[model samples]
Target: MEPPNILSSIPFKQSPLNPGELNLTHYCMSFLLSIPWNDISVTGFEYLAKKYRLDVFSDTSNPNEVLLSLAGKIILIDVIIPTHGTYRDIRIALAFADATGEQYKNTGAEEILLSAIHENNTTLLERNVALLAMLDRCSPSVQQSCFQYLETLKSTFSLIYTSRLNTQAFNDETEIIMSAEGKPLNDNDGNLGLQLAFWKHQDFLYTAKISMNELPSNSLPCALYGSNLVAETPLKTSGEVSWLPETTMTQIPATMELLFEDYHIVFPEFGVQSLLDFLQITDLDLSENFLPYKTLLNLPNQTTAGYPSMNKSHIIYLGGIDIPSRSVHRIPYSHPRQILGIFQYVRQYLTLQTIFENVKLSSTRITATASLRLNLIMKQYPVIHIQYQELNKLSNVDPVIANVSVLPNGIVQLNSIACGNTPINEDTALKIQKMLQKTLNIGLVLEFAIPKLFNNQ
Candidate 1:
């Protein structure tokens, strides 16, 4: 007898939502509804129902649950509004463990709901809650619509409103697993512990373990928004990146290892220089707020930061709007992403040499042992300007391929440089060498390879 086929033994099953078996059980979602008992204007809800021509049906049996029929699909949502409050709106939150489950299966429900929220002119807190409830909760088919619409809404809203939206939205697709065991500094009798969180995406993985010096609960509600206590302060945190990415270099010896696709860089000894570099970068004044988040996350889901989704990815730190004096000097683990994102924006305005000088002087030694990662996915390489002194002008000194690395002592090492198959005399090589050294204070070691010009230039 022939061996049984394992695949054929199992029954093929799929949800009727899509013929290809659209499974969205993992897309858990939560909703928050803040209704001021005194001011319950149904205008926005009415406008949305009228505009979409959606049929609304209230569950007579259960007052909290309501059903909406849209495009031949039923969206049954359960919301419980509080009957009483002192001086603020009563807040109620609903969680959908399976966003695409039978009860609430419509693909475009989030878009419709967001439109309703926008029309209602809801309070900032309520609006933010509603927005968070919908992030990564919709079906794949409706992602673009929901994301683009949110982008539009973000543009029209206040800079501070929904501050966490972009950060949360950008990282929505990446799931994080965390474990915590800690006590705040104020609790003298308690033991101070650590919190570890891990997130892994396509090309890389990262783990951050941090210890909180101050409890978040201790943060005062300085910024009040829509009757909710939304604190604008960041908790004091000290942590280390226990994995790759090299974005947050470690201050502890052998605490982390950075592994690129082809190169492996190691760091020894404590170095707060990169963190200092980061702080200096963040201190620079930015004329426009929220530009980094908007520019990076608002684009279509097809790409990230103007590069293919596979080629580019990001991790963000939603730092507090107002940094407390006590937490200012503390190395807050949750600030790099936003800092890096902002750096991406302001880097263009600054001179290249300035950045290079800072990186070179940083005590955080970044020395590579393996070869350079050949699979570089940059959008475009900046033009290399080498002033040729007009001594014996040789044809524009064509683009060259080189392996670049920063030495353990901070000097940049540009080795195995190649300028196509062309053979050059000592004078030509010496000229190229002198120009590069003069401009970048870096020397080169040549290795021949094909030279290619990019961007049609």
Candidate 2:
């Protein structure tokens, strides 16, 4: 018994432009063209595009529906404009829904378009209707191109008349955000095909092509990949390690259950405290005006500070972006990834202790379960917790925090930085022992006290 391959049996071959296919493809292309080039001019996107071979997705000969299938490989996407177009009269790949980025210009269609969303802005609506009519005549991809070129043109000509500008809006205890910094300039060809050209410099690189016949079904096992999860943590890196050898990828596989489906927290301004927590860092000598909280909280797509495509993988609060709380419900995907979180509090604790043993105490409350997660991740490594000790006076020795681990009488060793600016002195050691007694319920009872060193040396 011969069963037919459904796609093969139903011919899409009569013409790549058969009227039915043509209508759907053209309509889809129109919508695609409406949104092109991100409002932010990060060229790494094009570098990414070329790697994935997405430039071909715009080939006039290909069917537009192919895009709906190709959406799986994309983890993050930004659109300057968005439309609620359908493919073949069906909601295709609804999981990859879009949120439009409000157009980034002002005093023109850009302002009108953004304003129309919340109010009865008729002039903007009329202008947009005309824009849509022209958009309908085109393919979704070409429509995207229209906006992409518009961005370039604005960059070039607008700069001829304008001066350098700084657009930072929010700077507080909350976050740090980068700026447009420079004007974007591109050719008439637009940036799509030109994107993702270089290797090695990009965060992640790959290419893809879609054919209905070759598509994987929704049931296939897939894992989400996120690189430059900068908001998760930064390489404060008193030292540096090679990250691009792709060595960071653990054998951990797709089973590493993602807590979120996508991450769209842009300009991803993390608070100083939040940043410190995620990186498991001691307090830093940070300057001010560093980060900005983004505009994605229940924010509408394509609207100022937000867009539609932020899907479930997108988070509400980046770790250390706020106070650590196990009870902070998913009301906002607003929790730090717990496993790496413990070191935040512990690191600061150790640093303060090492520098100011028996000094004035600075008490801060951190949740406990996060420490459990951190311990789980780092359990493989041997650690010496010089432990916590309260200060009776500013003159009391601070706890030590550094990376060197040694056995008794082995060699000179350093403490982990989660404790102090300097190594523990003898009296400071007693304080640490006392603090541990009050904090943890169990541990090995080492019959030794810290030995004095610096003064003797």
lDDT per residue (tens digit) for residues 116-220 in model 2 = 423434333333433322222221333233233223324332332122221133242111101111122222111111111111111321111000111122221
Q: Judged by lDDT against the true structure, how good is candidate 2?
A: 0.24
TM-score of each: 0.20, 0.17
Clashes of 2: 66
Which lDDT values do the candidates have, in the order given?
Answer: 0.25, 0.24
RMSD of each: 22.2, 24.6
Question: What would the per-residue lDDT of candidate 1 be over residues 208-307, giving only the tens digit for each residue?
Answer: 2222111122111111001111123211123211122333222211111111112111111012223334434232111211122112212221211111
Q: How many clashes (backbone atoms < 3 Å, residues ≥3 apart in a chain or on different chains) does model 1 have?
A: 0
Model 1 alpha-carbon miss at residue 435, Å: 34
